[model samples]
Target: MSDSILDRANKGILGLKPYEPGKPIEETQKELGIQNIIKLASNENPLGISPKALNVISTQKDLNRYPDGNATNFKQKVSEEEGIKTSMITVGNGSNDLIEFVSKCFLSEGDNAIYSQHGFAIYPLAIKSTGASAIKAKAKNWEHDLSLMKELIDKNTKVIFLASPNNPTGTVLESKKIEKFLEDIPSNVAVFVDQAYFEYLEEEKHKVSFNLVENYKNLIISRSFSKAHGLAALRLGYAVSSEEIAEFLNRVRQPFNTNSLALAAGIKAIEDKDHISSSIEINKSGLKKAEEAFNSLGFEYIDSYGNFISFDSQQDSDLSFDFFLKKGIILRSLKVYEMPNHLRVSIGLEEEMNAFIETLHDYKKALDAG
Candidate 1:
């Protein structure tokens, strides 16, 4: 018999594992045969979609026509709000798409990309898809050790991915520390900072270095409307960089990477300050409540700047995850992040959080008794 066709696949892809997203509500219902499921797994905004965005999406009348390939108006809105030039902005189907665009534009065979341990999974996936090496630096206290990352950089390094308020851990890098690190690195290496959760941070913790894009030609900052703006379903996000790099990314991106509805909705979503504020407030309250519960239960949790919190299960997290599913709750297991004893839960409405807390206590007790 001939060798399997899989043997002819790209060498880089053959070694890669597919990303495991949080379980969907419908999938859980089917598997566990339970309804009334509340999903606190995907780190989505539980407050639901923004009314302004919905209004814009509903009024979108050109379904028969193609979307604006250039994403002009949305880019203009972002430029005006962020004080960046429109030429420096590149929109994508989602922030993940933007990540892939960067990889496609810069990474190649024998090249390498650097990211910290427990950084967003897409970083390595995107890099490896381009047949590039992904160098994971050792994390310090679940945060990016910038010095270690710098040491790992070599002539072969083409890009560096930094996730502030990193996923699964929610640890953020200090603004000045990141600036110093950037200054120390070689100018030839491109730096892509994934700030998907930037809006959830307190005002004081916000990075002034976002404006450094104007000065640093190699810097790119990716932002999303998915979290605070409640536009995840729209799949709208963008990257801000120097005009030169933006041109390269745009050249590699699909002409209609962002749809008409997403463009219209994103323009409205960014202007709805009240909705964003309310979302942040709800997250803050829910995070506080969850933290208090974890403390009383003697569970260890990372100090998170983002909307979700990862807590140690003190048992097999996969088993605990199954237990929660049986109880009509869906939380994220960190097995994919290589933290099998921890689970992450997104902030939801007060009642939803209460249910999660009560169910968690019950699960822990059952485990202890067993």
Candidate 2:
């Protein structure tokens, strides 16, 4: 009898807010009538696209035909690199698509999925939109509290999303800790690890061996080429999981979930080991630049293992966020993550970092005098 449009919409969606992404540089420039914008908002590679991927763009043909629905070649390439069978890989538009696929595959009305308090926003958007109950476990010091997460598990729970080198805060759950947590959780519940920033993690400490999946059938690992491979524009992501889980995920995935260019580019990007290395090197150097700048400002920051850093602005983030925008620097506000006083900045080029540092210094001086 209800005439309201929202009444027809999924009830769970009623309780959700739209996911707000970082503002694009072009949008900011057009809005402010300004130029020379440097964006540290999205965790994007400053190095841009891989040279190998760029090479394939010119070779792609057949605009008249649909892309490979199975993403056969791409899946085969991933299987080769990961040392897994193609049956175990699920291709997605982006890692976000993989997240949604898992959510839709397992969750329905009255079911619940769990994620950390400060976990990636896409987890909730993907899970809750399926009309499933989205549960949040309390985070300790802006990091996933696995014990608290375990305490929240109940019969209705279906999936648990874990993000290492987690977004916004950049906290990580070590492999040993992850294995222990997996051992404690119910075997029936799927655990989707969103590892979008997997390549950015330091090899010495990250230790995320893909062989972990061989032992845990319920485990699903989603990764994106957007961050480290500089392929954000192409919308390339995939999930590694048990064949049964991958089969179910594929059933719900769109036939052409990815485009022709994305498939070709993904293959090329994976082959360009040098490009991956160069991007990582730039990230490492940029992170150091951020540390020196933040330390000079006496800004209290979370120690991050990712390519970005989240720090306390020590004031309402709106003022600083807008201040940076006005100064042609674009980073992100953590208000959506429940840390309204924090801001996250993706590490940029050396010159861009220098500009950000100088602008920050100027802002402090102005704040003091005003």
Candidate 3:
């Protein structure tokens, strides 16, 4: 046999690019020798975890014992709240875990998975990891063009992933439009909706995904405690779908996929309405601050419903990304999403946003000086 280790790897793995997360504050401090770092890159909750969620950590005991393999309590709590049956919910380490579970369960080499052009990097990564073909439907104004996405659906289409208020761009596809799109698609093809930022949306836009799950047997809706719930560190998320879809997802999901800490904190996190409310209220204020500055600076930005925003860079995006990095700020560059001229910033606390606004102004001044 040939002694080539490369030959043993899957062909799909050869071409795949790993997901790039936002630079961590600790990493920035070590690399740049900067202590005062503010990160507006990963779309995390700037206000931090709720007191109720925090209170559970002190009570957690028996680290030697494994977590509930079936996530029974998680399903029951979610069922009580969502009016969805316990059989219809599957808990995971995070919403991304559920997304990957779906791909691994159903997709194969000949199968093709559809996603928006500017979709989350994890979508294609998960699809490709399973040796499935990833098809990109061109986006309109950085929003998913459902018509274009639907047209590409064919015999081999196993999954179509949609993101409302999609990451990076933050454009929303209306509930009615999504409903209509659901009406038009064939039942055999599964449509997975990532509503990871669901709690961050306004009252009118809330229930956009859940309202459709009951009517569509093939639909899967994913939600997270990472965003508005301020439990990103716990990495807890849940998905709602027909009992049939949840069954398949559970089959591929690893045993005890969700840790004990995430489950305990998540149960408390979901109950803390006050904490969620404050996150949204503060995010609204922070978004307004960033947008006003972007407007005054003459940068065009997509109208966003999520906790983060991306705007066009007047100069090379790399220059601006570096400019912010050197000043103890971490921002995301959208080059990986094929939008090389834009930069994404997650909404932060008042002081963090103030620092960002000041640094942004300095960058603008530097551009002018050059």
What lDDT would each prediction earn against the true structure?
0.90, 0.90, 0.89
Q: Rate residue 315 of model 1 by lDDT.
A: 84
User: After superposition, which runs of candidate 1 have C-alpha atoms over 4 Å from their true positions?
Assistant: 1-4
lDDT of 1 by residue, 196-222 (tens): 999988866456455788777889989
Prediction RMSDs, each to the true structure: 1.3, 1.2, 1.1
Q: Model 1, residue 58: what's the lDDT?
A: 87
Any runs in candidate 2 off by more than 4 Å, and if so which? none
Instruction: State the lDDT of candidate 3 residue by residue for 53-94, as single tens digits.
Output: 899977999879999988887778888888778998989898
- Candidate 2 shows a clash count of 0
Model 1: worst 10 consecutive residues (lDDT sum): 202-211
